[model samples]
Target: MATCLASGLGLRATAWSQTTDGQTQAESAKADPSQAEPSSGDTSSAVKSDTTTVTVTGKKKAPNDRDVYDVSKDLDAKTGTAADALNKIPGVNVDPSGNVTYHGRNVVVYLNGRPSLMLSGDNRGVALKSMPSAYISTIEVISNPGAQQSSGDGAPIININTQRNMPPGMFGSLSARYSSPAGSLETAFLGITKDKLSITLIGSYLNNEMDSRSLSQTSVLDSTDATLQASSSKGEGRSSYRGPFLMANLQYDLGPNDVLAAAFNYNRMPSDSTDISHAVSQAADGAVTNLFDQSGAGRFVTESAGLSGNYTHYGQKPDETLKMDGSLARSASQNDFRSANTYLISTIPGNTGTRIQTHDRRNDKTKANMHAEYNTPIGDDQLTLGAEVDLEDNTINSRVFGPADNDDNLMVNPLLTDDFRSHQVVSAFYATFQREVTPRWTVLLGLRGEVLHLATNDLTYRTKGNINYSRLNPSLFATYVISSQQKVRFNYTHRQQRPEASDLNPHIVYSSDTSVDAGNPGLKPQESDAIEARYEFNGKGLNYGLRGFWRGDSRTITTVSQIIPDPQGLGNIVTQSTRVNWRRRSAYGVSADVSRQISNKLMFSADATLTQSALRNPQISGVRSATSVDGGFSLNYFFKKGDRIFASYKRVGKSYTGQGYTTGSGQANIQYSRKLTDKFDLELMVDDLFRQTRTVTVIDTPLLQTRFVSSRQSPTFMIGLSRHFSRFGPMRAPAN
Candidate 1:
């Protein structure tokens, strides 16, 4: 399926707040009515009351700088991760694989103000899938980060704010949820606050399993339109994961003007998966020519831990502050895979050739980061200066064995093992200034300079080298207020994505019986220039927005495939895929979103987007592009006694990648929730009502053409119950 239509009428009333930042709104007064002392920027060294203070009102409000999503207001979930919640936000999209895109461009995710090691690489999707959304109080979507944010702000950013001031007592929450595919989630939160110290703890566990099946067809043809080889196969696989995630934070008030904090996070995931597929090849005359069957099973385990500390001092003046944060982390992973295969000709009743292979791989990595920023008021403008340093050390090893009793076949593919090591260091400094040119206009500009060094070595191939590159990233942001309820913003930013260590490892992986994949150690980093325009309107209980963006990439890394002659020679060849530096790529898109309250009991929202992307393959001297249209709508109904009913449907269009083009599709969900009591609730949900979720891929070339489809068309129903208790008193509606 390349596209799907999803439409639904919703009923329910909701409100949107014009103000941003919980600390700047009146809700803080409702959350804390104890006449407590001020916390944010109360830079008075000596104070009488040592009671716990709230920082929600910190610094001065930045009215024209960023867009903020108050998670508490827009979503109320008994069970779901931040990734799920983020998918519901306007102008944001999260693919089935949990890759997040904002305005048609990739974004960097941060916890508080620091980079989250767990939210990068494969770990990003998994960690976000398991992370409890409740831990994040707010999400700031910064389209143009200032120099003070340095490297992190270079690209669009998703900053998760997890810290909240605690009242003068101990409190927390406990929750458990179960879903389809035999998946379960459990979480606990505990916080304690004294006169001068605040302690918070979070613990969670996830046990999940999922399965899917697929069928595919492939044909190899000559330039004369004659089919040389045709094949078909059916495949299925199941995967399971069990893991524990934990975090702890400690904050102490050194005085009224300064604060000290430390935090630690850890997680371990153990997984198992298996797959099997069989295919038969036919000649142009429909005669069975060859048979191939393959099966594999594998186990993977990963572990990560991190510790960090922070010191913040609010200067003894308005709009002045100094903050320093540092963190260190370690992550390690291992995989063991085994497979068996058989190949035979039509004339042979028994297998002509057979082989068994075992593959083992391990990776160990360590990361360290430090950041410092200072902000002060200069005349009517604000200036920020910042510096940061990041370091990474990684080691990987892979080994393979074939046919316990065979050496002839092994020698054909002699290079079967390798040890790879990589080291990376990055240092950056930046400066930013924000000026209010007039009563209704604001301008901001920043520049960041970064230096990066990468070194890699391959013991098996005796190849070693070092790479050094540096660039200056600059950004500009401006806001023009048309009125109290209307405003327009313009933003331009430059960002970079460095190639991962895994991408630099020079090792060949037999991904399939007929195909192999390898990395390119000489690959360079990719850079992007992004520009966007946005307009927002909010008034009379209505919220609407429009946005457009264009992003261009240089030296983009892409995968290209070619037929390699098999060393066994028997007049056979195999397909091999390798990564290389592509010439360039570009994407641009426009989207709009509107949410309105139809009545006291009915609310409706809708969003649509159109995007086009193109890439230039320097190796092939060819260029290809694709366009997609995606959209979704939702309805909500609120009844008495805190009861609600909701319905929604979303569709995503096809995506173009270096490998091939993917299909587009969507799903529908209907849910009803009832408040059994003031602190207890029940929910029933029917998801994928139409079973429309399907995956399809296509690859076309002069000599080969292949198409594969995996239809995950299954209906699921779930029932959940939850209980909540809070001594901190009334819960304010989350900001929108």
Candidate 2:
């Protein structure tokens, strides 16, 4: 089971006193005509500052080219992670598993306009939560992205921009929270910046503990046409997690057009859990029959670190720019489990067995990329051309051990120890042209070509294999202004999906009494063709949008059970079974959202999505087609100077969980915040306020099949206070 919660707040502060002073001096000189003449006389030797200013009253204005989505203005006061900030953008959403989707598709996330540590494996969630929202300047959502981007499963492109300027100063924030059933968390951040150099640091710690209880019942029948028995199971589980993170960034401006930036990030997470279950069966003769009891405890620890350096050259003809970025990251996790079970039979003495298992895994990844772009203009049109080359190498190692009851000694299999390595290289070239065809009509043309090569090497007991694959993807988009306040756009793209290292290895690490999972050695990539159309309308104080999209994929990958056992007597092993052009899927969906400021202190936003998808596979009989529909709505109100109120509700209809059968879930949240003083604030939050129980039901159709149903419910509450401090100067404008 996966729990969803945001981590502590970590902020990176930079000092910009010199830049601020420059701006202030520039404004003063502009006001005094006598001083402006000398400043303009020496054009070649004078400093030319890069800055802009705008005034805001009661209405919103269009964003500038350099301005991404503003965090303070775009997100609700209750948002926690950067993911929450990104989701507020049009055509952007984050799934329950923490995967970000754009325009109902997948997208990659970039930090500071470069590929960072967040793009890899399971670290995405941790990275998102550890980064504080206050440190972010803006988030950009790119739908039909260019070819210079990394190629992967289709996802919207998201770029997170950090604050670039603060007075030569230091600032930080502290916060604490608690949940009724989930747990408690505390986080803090601090940073310092000065002159032409700036350094920002962040640290956070979190502890989450959860307790749950459940009951289930099942009936089984034998192949001899005889009713075996009915069984009832009751179980309780407790789970807890403690995680800490530290990150630092340094930026030095060599000159007005040259800069060097370095960053380092580290995270450590430790978790422990225990589960106990007992089952009792009633015989056909109405007597107590077989009884079984099982219990297990497990501990897991993961640590990851990343380091990267970036050099940028910003001065060149046609406003050219070149960026070189390289990064290395490594992570490791260890898990241990201990279990004991007793089986009772009528004729023989009860059999008792105990097993202890441990698994240790490690992953190391390195990536390097270079990007160059040149911008030029022809007549009234603007053209930009860019190219990028990226290389990534990843390696993984795993070891597992199991021991018998009285032996108290663990045994390792020579064949089970395995090492897997994967290498990928992507080269892309792209160009974008924007032209003002007419006063009321503007056209933009963009094209990108990408070539990808992936190679995987597996060294394991059961199989030794190597596989390579290449792919080419293209995309196109267009937008037209029907009127001054209305616009329409259309986009189309073809994308590819490559299997991860863990999914491609042919190894069996762990198994249960009834179910076993094994990896596949010969898996192929999947391709998708997607298209979408959208329209937007901007009025006095309201912005509204509607979009429709359709996606079709080939060679879709799905896990299925194998009919035969492994020849090596690995017991009932389940391997990845490929359908080989036997499966086809198509989905279409539409979404609409509206944002408006009802008054000076009140704002409202709501969005809804509805989609229908179908799967056709002849090889798998009795498979039913399913559809999913989900949406959410939110309202926020401000009052009494610095107080805020928020309410939100989300619903997910019956959706397939891949194990055959459908599940439904929903959640609601309410929060309030008040400013106790200029530097202090307090907040109260409630999660799952409705206490809605999420349930999943499974039905087996084959002979001797059984039915099982399970449900889980949790509700929590939290209260917190936040404070700010500035060492060098008074706090500047609140971070937006």
The most accurate candidate by lDDT is 1
Candidate 1 lowest-lDDT run of ten: 4-13
On the 0 to 100 scale, the lDDT of residue 180 in model 2 is 71
Q: For model 1, name the residue pairs that clash.
A: 10-635, 11-636, 12-602, 12-603, 12-636, 23-56, 72-734, 73-734
Query: If scored against the real structure, what TM-score would every candidate get?
Result: 0.86, 0.79
The local lDDT score (0 to 100) that residue 421 gets in candidate 2 is: 77
lDDT of 1 by residue, 451-531 (tens): 988899887788987989888988888888787567788988787767778677777755555566678878887877888
Candidate 2: clashing pairs of residues: 16-166, 16-167, 17-168, 72-736, 106-154, 106-155, 106-156, 107-155, 107-156
lDDT of 2 by residue, 672-729 (tens): 8787887777778776787654455553323223334544444368776767774224
